[model samples]
Target: MKFPKVQLALVQMRDAGSKTASIAAATTWIERAAAEGAQVICLQELFATCYPCQAEDHTMFDLAESIPGPTTDALAELARRLEVVIVCPMFEKRAAGVYHNTVAVLDADGTIAGIYRKMHIPDDPLYYEKFYFTPGDAGQPRASVGPDKPNGFNVISTRYAKLGVGICWDQWYPEAARLFALAGADILLYPTAIGWIDEEKEEFGAGQLDAWMTSMRAHAIANGIFVGAPNRVGIEGRVEFWGNSFIVSPRGEVIAKANSADDAIVTAECSLEEMDVVRTHWPFLRDRRVDAYGDLTRRFID
Candidate 1:
């Protein structure tokens, strides 16, 4: 089936200290993207505020807000006015003590379409996410299973296509991408805020960025689907986010790429027709031996 060509805009921005600055910067970028004929737009992870996971200070919890809070309300209105789908990532305070790294998908009509929480939480030097967010229960393929429930990925259908939303750490796992593809996702969207630490920038920065981009591209090629990664740029606290945001086509070719340290809107035209063509020629999904992969359920087979 020949699908309509969809234009996507990825907004890569510097970490703005306050929500006011962040919203203003995002609004400006969204207007620019609309003028360029973008139907779907995505912002970087934790775009509303600076990367708060840099430290485990309890005061950082003040940044968290309800899903339908002011940020989403404003973005929804913007989506309606522009007639575009907006993926807004925010620090979500789910309940009294529960919090999450969540992305809210606002439809063209300005309605809240769906929300996907970041299933994978990374606990590294500058990234102390485990101190703030509770790991999402979205049931990715690698999720630990309980005796009563089975784990599977979540694929949300939009007007344009079926979207599988994954945050930064989730993008590193091929299993996450493959499970989403198996669940019939046409595209995988990753909202990220990744960067180099103070000292590691000189030693491991280049390799880290390369691995990040290459992994996502490999996911696109392996799944025969489009992959979109919108990452933030600029220095925030001790970490400097490397802003190499890009969109990879079904054939694993980068159609659009942003700079490594700039606040720019990267647009890409995705052709869904290529998905059918590519998957037909390379039938990896068809040859999968599901019965032989039971070992995947274990953390590590010794």
Candidate 2:
């Protein structure tokens, strides 16, 4: 269970106004990550398209594409050529009207490893995900309250590492991270598109970003696994997407971090031995109270 040292890369970039432009920009970044010796690379959520969930527009449904559609086809070729693991998030067109916010993991050989649909759909202001996406399977009733799917918190095994993929809102939930850790994921990758709504920037921006990062860092500390999050980095509409994408070690140490307002590629060398050391010292998983957490399934503990 010893993972070798891995050069993890987070491609943090701004949207280029159009899907074609965005894809091209991401392609360049991916190539850059590979050239810099990043064995595993993850792009921001919806890298092919700008953040379109700002408002519930019926036309936005056009953005959804099949899992093996054009985007993955292009990424697959790139992954094969570079021989690097790629984690790509896209708006999926499951059926006619059904869509899910999912990330398709491409193995180093360019094969589709698996897709993790966003389990927790947030419905807050400026982030109307429920309007467009259906939540992914959360296992039976007790494991999760979301709709059931055959793939529940799947951990994909690629040539480089076993990745537990999660989307933006999923990062806010500890259950998502714990499930991945327990399932033997070497690292947790969150492809996110979160930002500050223009109106709330002055008051809650700093706190919001701190909470977002703190939660993910806590996951790394608790699970004793690497955590890599690549976030969008520009103002699309009302929200200014905070870039600050980063990688953290098992002990919650910041390995590499991007600037808050810049398009950059952040890379860090993470040692698998560090994970074992941290987990041995702080054996939280070994002392979990699993038998007493049955009520976690209830809607409210009333």
Candidate 3:
């Protein structure tokens, strides 16, 4: 099967307060990318507002909106006008007290294509995602050790490509990436907000960033698929986001990368042909012993 050679744009931007400013910035970036011939564009996570997970304030809930609400509507219109597929991540308010970290996909025709909720909610220091988001039930088990098993991966097909959307913390897990690849995703897209804590900046920031990039690159190599990460830039509260948004080829090469602290659009052209070529050369998928990996369902072997 032959797929089109798709051009992807990763919009790396700083947090903004008003929807107007964020949308404006996104418009400019999208226009720039479209002029450069990008067919698919993705923005950083929570691009419309500052990373609210920084501190738990009930008032932050006001930022949440429905799928077809103002933000998505505007993005869908822009996508149709530009004739590009747009992936917009939003803070979703499903109900009064229920919310999720969701990414809405707008097709080239300006229609709402699909929505993928963040399944992994991290509750680490400086990142309090679990306090606000209800981890997405991808119809899977919550615990690896339990009798219940996760359905593996959630896959979505866009007008341009078969995509797998995962949020910030989800980027750290190989299980998520592998499952997405196994489910037939041609591209793994991660809308992220990873950064350095004020105190950790001097001690381990560089190492942390290196590890992050290394992991994503490994995902591309292991899965034989293109991987793209659109991360936020600039400082917000106790965290200083390390932009460095990038696109990696199926060969695990960094084709395009943005600056660590700049708002820029990184574009890369991915050929589905390359994925097939790489996978054929390195048959990781063909060699997988699925029937012998039941221990992966456990949290820890010990």
Candidate 4:
């Protein structure tokens, strides 16, 4: 299959005090990226609001909005005007007392293409995502929205690219990346909001950051697809958000990376044709022993 070279952009920035401010700032960055020739752009997770996963508060539920609500509406219009594919993460209010960490993909025409609800909800010390999000169900391949296909991961097709979007925690799981790649996603986009806990920084900051970047790069190399991660920056409460947003090519090369201290937008041209060459040379998928991998389904081999 022939693919065109696309300019991928990631907007890495600290959250402004207000939603209006954050969105406005993101708009400016998006415009800048477009002006610089970016065809596909991704914003940090929950760009419209602060990282609410910092704590489990009832008020945070109010921040969740419908997928086609005001936020998506505005973004759709902006995407159409800019003629760029946008992968935007948000706190989704599916219904009363029901919500999910979802990212909606907007096509170049400014239409709602599809949504990918976070499948993994982590409940660590400061990150309380499980408290707010209902895990998405990934059922049979290409299943409908019925009970069988509750949390279907959608690979949105747009004029610029086929996007496979996952939230922060989802980036750690290779299964998600593989599934998306198998489903024909040319680019894997992870809109993230991750940082160092002040207390842990002195001990594990460097290692954690290395592991984070290493894991994402592995996904790009193994899947033979472009990986784009747009992370939040600045200190918010006990968490000092590490910025370093980046884009990695199929060969696991870091095409562009942002600084760890400030608001930035970085863009790079991703050669989609390289994926075929890399995969052909690597041939990991072609050599996979699928029949012998049943143990992967078990909780513990023991």
Q: Any residue pairs clashing in model 3, and if so which?
A: 141-150
Across residues 86-175, which tens digit of lDDT does each residue of candidate 4 receive? 888899998888898888888888888788888988999899998999998667555464311334555777787888889999999998
lDDT of 3: 0.87
Q: Relative to the unseen true structure, what is the C-alpha lDDT of residue 26 in candidate 1, on a scale of 0 to 100?
A: 98
Model 2 scores a C-alpha lDDT of 0.88
Q: List the candidate 3 regions with Cα displacement exceeding 4 Å.
A: 1-3, 140-152
Superposition TM-score, candidate 3 onto the true structure: 0.94
Candidate-wise lDDT, in order: 0.87, 0.88, 0.87, 0.88
lDDT of 3 by residue, 217-261 (tens): 999999999999999999998899999999999999999999987
lDDT of 1 by residue, 205-271 (tens): 8999999999999999999999999999999888889999999999899999999878999898888
Badly placed stretches (over 4 Å) of model 2 are 1-3, 140-150
The alpha-carbon deviation from the true structure for residue 94 of candidate 2, after best TM-score superposition, in angstroms, is 0.6
In Å, residue 28's CA in model 2 sits off its true spot by 0.6
Clashing pairs in 4: 137-151
For candidate 3, the 10 contiguous residues with the lowest summed lDDT are 143-152
lDDT tens digits, residue span 32-125, model 2: 9899898899999988898888899999988889978899989999999999999989999999888999888888888887778889999988
Q: Once model 4 is optimally superposed onto the true structure by TM-score, how far is the C-alpha of residue 215 displaced, in angstroms? A: 0.2
What would the TM-score be for candidate 2 when compared with the true structure? Answer: 0.95
